[model samples]
Target: MYSTIFSHVGKYKKEAYLSPLTIVGEVLMEVLIPMVMGLIIDHGIRKGNIGYVAGMGGLMAVMSVCSLCFGALAARFSAVAAMGFAKNLRSALFRKVQGFSFANVDKFSTASLTTRLTTDVTNVQNAFMMFIRMAFRSPIMLVCATIMAVRQNRRLSVVFLFAIPVLAFAVFFIISKAHPRFEKMLKKYDEMNGKIQENLVGIRVVKAFAREEDEKKSFGENTNSVRLAQFAAEKLVVMNMPIMQLVMYASITAILYFGGHMAVNGNIETGELSSFIMYVSQILMSLMMLSMLFIMFVISRASLQRIYEVLAEEPTITAPEGAGARARDGSVRFENVSFSYYDDMGNLALDHIDLDIHSGETIGIIGGTGSSKTSLVQLIPRLYDATEGKVFVGGHDVREYSLDTLRSQVAMVLQKNVLFSGTIRDNLRWGDENATDEEIIEACRSACAHDFIMSFPKGYDTDLGQGGVNVSGGQKQRLCIARALLKRPRIIILDDSTSAVDTATDSSIRKAFREKLADTTTIIIAQRITSVMDADRIIVMDGGRITDIGTHRELMQSSEIYREVYDSQQKGDDE
Candidate 1:
């Protein structure tokens, strides 16, 4: 997991390596400064040798300046390396998600992915920054300071052996207790973010239903939960500092008491005893740095694992090697097909089904909710692989064609009409980026969207706010249809795409499909009988299986489900 995540430090290898090298220079200078100060005190000040004092003082000044420069360079390099690494990691994650099948996305969920991309990546980046600097400097400083301290006064240095273990045990205890709590906190973050996203997306609904206070109360509860989780995790982490400070002060006090007595007895010089005290502080400070680094690791380890989970996830669907590109025709055939989102036959969403659709045929499907009409069309583009049996697009099995090749030829306007935050022209260009203005206008005309679009001040250039919030529901549906029409695809599936529009506009769209898309196969999934009554063939579905297939008039006489639906609509129209 560490190898996979850290491998994203791609082009910043130079900075990543250089940062620690500079940090080593900084540590070396820092270690030498106290030794120089001792020489100034013992040889220059104590002996009244002013020249020796002046020379050594100059050297210490130079060392301090060099240490500052090295510290600054290390900071710059580490920042660049960490930020660059995070950029690559986030890009890789997004690209991986783009390749994931619907089943794979459903497995992890959108909210969890968002957390990994933003907050989790940020955490890993921070840890990497601390790791590069402290990981090298702390241990190097600790060893060098300890050696120097022992050389000055071995008896005084024994204090560290005792102090070190105390700090080590404290860090270990905090890390062991805090890791699971941090993991729980991150889960809470996911839940809070999910609630916020859901509420923002449905803000209009909440307002229309006069549920603003309810939503506010729910959101407040979610944020409070996140706060409590964070507090629980941080409570243990905060223990690290007080314990470290206690150890440091005690170590310092023991060093001063023993070194002062040694100096009084002439066992250690005044300069040596002063320098020994400095070394003890350095030794204790290094241990504290290591403890802090450990705490950082404990916090980021959970984030790292979460990121690795995404990085390691194999996309459930992948294009077969040596896959074909072009479809033979728009013809699609399903033979003994069954599917379950969970890949269990017992829990099938689409039961064993057999059907064939000829190229360029207009087939209309009518079903109540949960009938899996959307599931049936999703297979044509290989959005999901059938759990059992074969789904063929053109002639070969759907899996035989590359996903891009199959999907390019199949334009699916899903049940949800989604338009991005861009100009109408930009949205339409998704169908055919190179589509000419004339072609754009024609597609809109075919979808009966041109008149309403031209009514806007900027016409095609008018910006559609996020999710096309600037437009009415019916307008959004029409714009989406126009965008799909611009694809000039071999197969087009409209899964309740026109439900927002009035019946007159719906009728016009169906007429336009007949006149303009004559050579293209069209499948319309709808609740209204009028939407499919005029089709060459109509499929009536119940549960997961297709119960009947016939023309409107033929189904009225033969299929009880169809006749009941048609009669109900007829009675409603008369009323």
Candidate 2:
């Protein structure tokens, strides 16, 4: 996990190296300051050697300035390195998500992925910053301070033997107890973020239903759950400070008492005893810093695991080697295809299905809500691979072509129309980034979206707020259709895209397709019989299997299901 995450340090690796180098210099200078002060006390103050004291004080002042400079440099290097690492890691995670197939995305829900990208990355970044600075400094300070303390008097240094064990055990115990709690706390954060995303995305529906009180109650519960989890984890971590301080002070007191006697007996000088106490303080303070590093490591370990889950996940779908062939034509063939979102053969969303669609053929598919109409079409673009059989597009298996090469030739306007927060021109440009203004207008006209678009004050330049909230449902659908038209793909699959438009407008769009897209394979999935009645071939599907395939007149005479649907719609139209 560390290897994968730290690889993102990239160009800032120089700064990462420099941070520890500077920290080492700072620690060395800090260790020498106390020794120099001891000289000022022993030789200069006691013996009245003012010249020696003045010289040592000035040296100490120089060392202090150097230490400050080193510390400041270390801080800057670590900050840059940490921030760069975080930026790279977050970008890598987002790119990975973009490459994930539908199944991969469904496995780790959107909310969980969002949490890993933001909160978990930040946690790891902070841990990294602290690790680089303290991990080296603390141990170096401990070793140097211990050697100095022992030189002054080995007997008093023995107090560290007892104090070190107590502090070590405390750190070990706290880390072991707190780690699992931190893992649980991060999971709580995922849950809370999921709730917030859901509520905000559907804020309109919540208000329309007058469920404000219920949503508030639910949000409060989620927040309270997070607070409780955080408190539980922190409750154990907070024990580190008091335990460390207790051990530190007790060691100091033991040194002060025993060394005072030694000084009175003239076995140890007063200056040496003072320096020894200072070394003891430095030693204990370094140990305290080490303990804090361990605590931070424990917390970041959980985030590390979460982040690695995203980083290590291999994309379920990828272009095969030497697979750059584009589709030859719009022809699509499904041979014994079956699919399951869970990849379980027992639970199929698209059952064993065999169908053939020729280039430029107009095919209409009608199915009930769970008939997997969308599932069958999604296979053409390789959005989700067929679980059982080959889905052939342009005379080759869909998987034989690179994803970009295949999907670029297939324009799919999905059931749930989506328009991003951008100007109308910007949204349309997604289909063809270099589309000229005339091409944009022409596609919109064919989709019957040109009138409404031009009706706006800025025309194509009008900003469509988030999710196209400024437009009605029908307008959003038409705009999405226009966007797809801009692709000028060989195959265009409209999955109930015109459900929001009036029948006359829908007919106008279909007529425009016939006139402008005569050579393009048009697949329309619709509920209204009138939408598909004029198609060259109509498919009836039920229970993940095709029940019938024929032209409207042929189905009306032979297929009872088709006949009943037409009669019910015809009666309704008459009434």
Candidate 3:
């Protein structure tokens, strides 16, 4: 865990090293104070030297103050370093996730990713701070105190030998029981986080259905699981506290009795015995800090394993070696392509169906649910690999182009619209950082989003809630379309993008795109028949195969699937 955290300290190497150095310096000062005290007791006070005692006492006080100064600074440095490391770690993880293909993400759910980014990172940060503060503190103090105690009186130091083993066993026992519990606790915490994410995201459904009580019960179940795991782990820790106290008390009692025997029998000095008791206190307290380190080790070990899981995973779809050349033409072709998910091999997503979409031409895709409409379009962006065949963009295999270059030329508005919490202008700028105000307005106008956006008091600068929850479904869709328009990519994929917009608005958006974006290749995947009725060409898909291909009127006459869909939608409109 320590090594993994060390690796994550990239770009913060200066702070990471300096933070620990300051902490150790502070610990050294603290350890010095006690040694000075032992010296003062044995030399200054024993010889009845008042000046020596006062001078030593003043020096010790100065050392204490120095320790405080170093400690305060180290704490500030440590906190700053920890936060910096965590921020970098989160960004790194998010980038890693972005590079991953859909298949890579399929291995874990959204909830698990959330846990890795949030709870897991927090665990590492906390463990890092604790390790920096306590890791060296206890060992240095313990070793120094032990040497001083033994030096004070050899026989009295024997107490430490017995006390040490007892403390070690107390730590080992709790750690063994607590390690698995902490793992379980983290899992439960993920469940709790997942429950909250689900409920908050679907709160409208919960309310509309009037199932608040049911939702509460679901939340309570997840929360209870977390509570139980935490309680079990803490119980073991709490139990160890009492056991450690018993051992410390017993050691103290033995030390007092035996040290008195040493002083009375002329084997040890009175002031020396005082130092032994203090040394004994340091030893026992040191045990407590060491135990905490053990628990932290358990937590960090688990978190490190999780972090390693992501780092070690190889993204399945990586560009081939020396695959740097890119073409300006955005033509896409699928040659004898076949693909399937990991678990369900028999359930092929796309099979041996060839497709060629010309550059600067509009291609509309129509399909039923699970007809591979989105899957086929996602291939243009190389979000996944064809399981058996090849996907070519720009007259070369997608794997031939650099990943960044290939993706840069393609703009895909997902079926599920998602927006970050930012102003309309900010979101639009994500598509094109150098986009001017006029360009942004032009993109919004083309997406049919300009009118509604201008209606708001703040217009494009208005604050949006997370995922654009403040906006209506149709508004979010239009904003997403505008964002894609701002990108000005060679290829634009509308994956059921205008579903939320009314038919008239959707038509206006298509007309605007047809006029302004004639040079760009467009792939329109829609559920509604009317949505694709005016496209230059339409491909009807059924069960992952291209069943029919032609213009809307041609397919409507020749394709039974298309005819049934048109009739069904026409009847629904009449009703």
**Candidate 3 global lDDT:** 0.85
* Alpha carbon deviation, residue 373, candidate 2 (Å): 0.9
Per-residue alpha-carbon lDDT of candidate 3 for residues 393-486, written as tens digits (9 for 90 to 100): 8888888988888888899999999999889899889899999999999999999999999999999999887888889999999999999988
- Cα lDDT, all candidates: 0.92, 0.93, 0.85
Candidate 3's C-alpha runs over 4 A off are 1-4, 11-53
Candidate 2 lDDT by residue in tens digits, 1-575: 88998899899999999999999999999999989999999999999999999999999999999999999999999999999999999999999899999888888898899999999999999999999999998999999999999998998888988998899999999998999999999888989999999998888899999999999999999999999999999999999999999998998888889988999999998888988898999999999999999999999999999888988998878879999677888999999999999889999998999999999999999988899999999989988989999998888888899988899889999999999999999999999999999999999999999999889999999999998989998999999999999999999999999999999999999999999999999999999989999999999999999999999999999888889889998999999
Per-model root-mean-square deviation over C-alphas: 1.0, 1.4, 2.6
TM-score of 2: 0.98
Task: Show model 1 residue runs off by greater than 4 Å.
Answer: none
Q: Judging by TM-score against the true structure, name the best candidate.
A: 1
**lDDT order of candidates, top first:** 2, 1, 3
Give the number of colliding residue pairs in candidate 1: 0
- Model 1 poorest ten-residue lDDT run: 323-332
Cα-based lDDT at residue 322, candidate 2: 96
Cα lDDT for residue 175, model 2?
94
Clashing pairs in 1: none
Query: Which 10 consecutive positions of candidate 3 have the poorest summed lDDT?
Result: 1-10
| Candidate 3: Cα lDDT at 262 | 77
